[model samples]
Target: VEVRPNPGGKGFVTALGGKWGWSGSGRAFVPQLVMYAGPADYHNKPKKIDADIETYLVGHGFNGFHTIVCCRWFDINEERSTRIKGPAPNPDPRTFEALELLIGKVHSAGGMVHIWAWGDESRRQTPVRLGGKNGLADLRLQRYIAARLGPIPGWTMGYGYDLDEWVARKDLDIWHRHMHAQLGWPHLLGGRSVGPNRYRRGAKFPQIYEGLDYSGYEQHQPTYEAYVAALAARPKRPSFSEDRFRVRKPSPYPKKDYTEELTRRGLWHSTMAGGVANIWGKYVRRGQKTTFQPYDHPEWIKTNALFFKGRFVKDMIRDNQITDGVCLRRPTGEHFVFYKEGAESIRMDLSKMPGSRRAVAVDALKPYREIDLGELRPENQTWKAPQKSDWAVAVGEFRK
Candidate 1:
């Protein structure tokens, strides 16, 4: 399944009076954040493995897939823990090999693989058990396996750092050279539990509260300051709406202003909204009583994904001002100024500009043609306007 970009693509929103290239908003795909569930594998080897999930994803116009390879290796938190079965301190030869095969397949489909390190694994510089092996040391094992696997292409690197921690570690300046960094993998950080949707009263479990203690916005100030100090200074981050979602339908908490903010910022932090089970238990299952929306009813994910995807299209269109009727212009180097009668938004490829090589970048992925997000409907009753509450403020501050 080799996929090449559609040259100039069928322009989603052409300047000339062309119908929107895509049906609704005219965007290709939404970014993904998938977690692994089901079989715990130190060496999970399914002879007749079913990749219907991947195939299904392709049918929906997804640009890519993010597979969780070599994680849940260890879940180290204050909660009582059960050691996963298998050998430790030594790598599971089978699991290591399977990861290679998985990476190969994903890359072939033009999908990206994101090897995750969760829980204490991110914070701990030490190795522990993963299945039969310890993660601290096993990461090295993964590296060794990767050495054999070589660079298969189409993969990302997600470490178990909260958004703030990324700033903190960046401040310390050793992140790039650390053992984890040694893999030279791309970064995709996540580790937030208990979204407002999950909690009836903002937050339910006290442990969720504890996790937030470290995830707070002010906590990230030092992290940001550290970034400022180490990076030798730069402009503040661009404005973009940022949000975290919860499952069980009818998003218990939806904030509007921040929603706009995430839209304005052109950035976000999205969670598939389940522990490991989201991926393994339901989505990968067939005809089961799905507890989640998208998995239980594919239509839900399709509609909702459209809602989110529409925003991105809106952002890019706003920023790029690729207008025929709207009339577009790029007044300066990187700024894509939109103008019809009045101005709207500016699009910038930060990396395209000088001194921005190391900065966060904006990119457009090729289309795949599969639907991962379910149906779109009015926000659940619990959904709230973004700016009307502190949700955005809290999230804005979360990473500082």
Candidate 2:
């Protein structure tokens, strides 16, 4: 498939050629997390695992997954312990077979795959490890990967997680050159930049790498302002949040620094700010034997419904001046989407939006229950919610 940046530079389009086309109106890609622990330990039930993951992604409105191609904990030399010898040409045939199977399943489900060469652990796989001495090994590895997986539809290639920490710009350019020469099909290439921390460090990948089709950020605690700023800073290509903090219930960590609510808010915030993609960080149990099950969260499903099913997100742009809260409106003023964090009435200036319109409000906490605001006139109006909590409002021509 030919997947290129949309004309607006806000999302992607796959209409040029191929069996796969854009699925939803959201115009954004949201992928789930899948960390493979090499063939030795995790290849026993590959088919069943692939089926479960496919079901979950299709059922939950996710279009793809952010997958680590290497073994889990590959950064730790002691933990990896000869499990992975080097980059690419993973000696075992079963590994490539399993990957191909998974990719095939994803394509059949109408989803894409974001392939990460490494995991969050970045220090181990450097240019030297990828064969930087003569660059032949690196070129061969790129050729090996492209030859095997390049023909597949609905997938993109990424350098790795936390790529800025270890790989240099010159090395990445060389790798890109090799991959570009090898792959005959059209595909996007990107890399995950360093994440936010106490130091408030911003990612540099978008500024440094000129060949990236989409810019990636690992924002742990994302906000509307931060995403807007980031989007404004890089206006040429689409932006994706590879990691926006994992969503695990029942407090997996002691402090519970991240929560599902935060993740949900981040999803909407990022989307409203023009981010083309975001990954849901739901991890599998860590051990030699890796296992995964579909999450039973309906909130994510509702959010996706609101974006793709309810609204024409591809035609909207961030315009906060239209309302007191976060607003996204079509350039022609036919539709308006507002998101407010607290439960309160929003004052929207709709005088310019002419004609009678229909408005619907959904509480962010309980999005399934939508409260219809009935028909509204084209004038400045104040819309109230059913109760107090985070809410999302959609006002425009109603479709049956």
Candidate 3:
């Protein structure tokens, strides 16, 4: 489907168009990370894979899947190391088959897919190693991808995971120019910015690349302020947080890094910052079966349901000026959202709006249950939460 920037220039709108924040099917396109287990997984256990996808879409509130298509993560082929002495390597038919099946499943289930064509270790797949002296081999490879995956609806494309590290500016420009022309379909195209500190220059990629339809940011542990700053830096198009601190088991780091509270805060912070979408990273161990369990994190499911399927989500804009805490509000000031980390009460300035409004306090720890604050006035108001934990307040008309 054709996805373009919304009229506001901060979000995306699909061919089935309505307003910003909604996908082609008129659903909020919140993406969740899904690691692929190679073509064999798709070929060998098609029914099981389909069931897993269903769980993510229906059981969980996610409507998008951010997946990798090639290179190290996906053992598509040995062409990268072999460095064959001929024309550019042809697209792997097996990869194509696997993607086709996966894409079809997501589309049928009413979800979108964001495809990362390569990963951090994909430099060898490009002309940097394949001897495409004039860049013909790289162009050929990309064109094959465009021709095969372009026609599919409900998906977007990214050059790779950490693009700023190895992709040259000249090559990026060339690819943008050629791929836009070859793909006929209106799938959005952009690359993930390298994680912070990789280059001394520190992420010089433009907020609005020439032919790209969106901007992306990747960070291992992005703070709420960082998410706000990144989206503020790229106001021209829809911005996506491709990678955040992952929620994984077996402690990839020395400490228990991925707590439920951490994930919940990231989700709300990113959404309140005007991010069109963000991915929830899930690290899977080698040879471990993929289990798409939404119930693993009940807090996440509740947060997703409250925001994406909520009433005011369509009109909310980041407005920290409304309160001391992180906030989002409607342009008309009729509705307001205030989020405070570990604060029992939040003060909001609604004096200008001048009307009675309903307020609901949501404890971040137990979002499934909300405390009603009864009716509140448009004057300056402070709503106290039931406890002094991380909390969010919804003012004005809100979904129960």
Candidate 4:
């Protein structure tokens, strides 16, 4: 199955222009630069935009903005009731110019500016408009704009959450087939090789046009991983790793004390990036209203940071790596638990925890409590499920 890269794993932007993840603490502490304030509030008419951005970049250690909220980018299909209203006849340069100024300010202050994509297929307010060329022309237009703007060098060009609504339209299977046929990729590489101009890693988005090069997938890891693998396997693709920028409340969803769950998910093997992550607004419109709840606190931040250090730092901190080690049971205290990292030998004590019925699979925790012994990897046999967790009370166990 396809999987997303774990965002929790501490990694650095590398020399090969690819993000290499490993278990460790990341130095760049990320804070949420929520773009809730209107352009007037940031521009010189009201306040100094560049000075504000500089304050955050140099002073607060916040390096990125989550969105450009209320920027009039979502005017697509305005006549439709689900959309804004009426025909969105023209572009609002005031709003666009303000964003441009904000972006420039952020860049000047040594910060990365990304588009908080609020567009939709229904609300066709995308800067790169889709058209007759099967939407390929729209993509090309986006590329042209990127070419004109030149490269933002350090900025991460990532879209807002609903990325599936954007790319799910592309026939990946079809794209793969034609590209592979053109590239003449080797059969040993898995896909069929057809043409003579064949080469591995064909021309792709980042090379063609640089807009929206990164994906901010706000869900589980599986889908993102699958996409990256597919893109990499194609004729030629850039180093693309999807980011899990948002997700459901890890547990006890919306109970406020879910910070511990944040510690768990962000610091666990499940996440590919670092522990420090920020999600904008509330989960939805009905349950919790969009209140200005600023998540600004040091105790909680360090609490997360400590947990982060414990996971990422193996020797220096408690755990070998932030996203490493074994979690024998689901934190929600559900059935069927083990180290899910495909690691063979992991130590855990499931004795103390409450259990109605217990069975531990010898190989690994599969979906149906099934694991193939023969298919198990050779190297993952270092840590076995421990008889007793050295630090915790003893819980009973049974081997299935």
Score residue 361 of candidate 4 by CA lDDT: 39
Candidates 1 and 3, the one with greater lDDT: 3
Candidate 1 vs 4: which has more TM-score: 4
lDDT of 3: 0.61
Clashes of 2: 0
For residues 1-400, could you state the per-residue lDDT of candidate 3 as single tens digits? 8766544221223422211243433433344444444454565456966786766666655666666654422236442434445545445667777777777777767566777765554546444555442265666666776787777766777777666667666656777778878887677777766544222223443532444667676665566666666656656666666654556666667342466567777677766666546666455555645543354665565654565456435556787776878887878877887888889788888887758888777776664666788878878777766679877787787553
TM-score of 3: 0.79
Per-residue alpha-carbon lDDT of model 2 for 1-400, expressed as tens digits?
A: 8766444222222421111124332343334333333433334566665665545564555566555654332222223323556654233455556567666676666566677765433445433454442265546556766788776656776777666666667756777777778887667777766644221335333434766666676665666766776566566666666653555544466242356566567667766675446666555556554454344565555554455453634546788887888887888888888878785888888888868788878877764666889887889888887677777888896342
lDDT computed for candidate 2: 0.59
Candidate 2, after superposition: displacement of residue 210 in Å? 2.8
Please provide TM-scores, in order, for all candidate models, with all chains considered together. Answer: 0.40, 0.79, 0.79, 0.41
In model 2, pairs of residues that clash are: none
Off-target runs (Cα >4 Å) in candidate 1 are 1-30, 33-50, 54-56, 66-88, 120-139, 145-150, 161-175, 179-246, 249-400
- By summed lDDT, the worst window of 10 consecutive residues in model 1 runs over 391-400
**What is each predicted model's overall lDDT from 0 to 1?**
0.28, 0.59, 0.61, 0.32
As for candidate 3, its clashing pairs are none
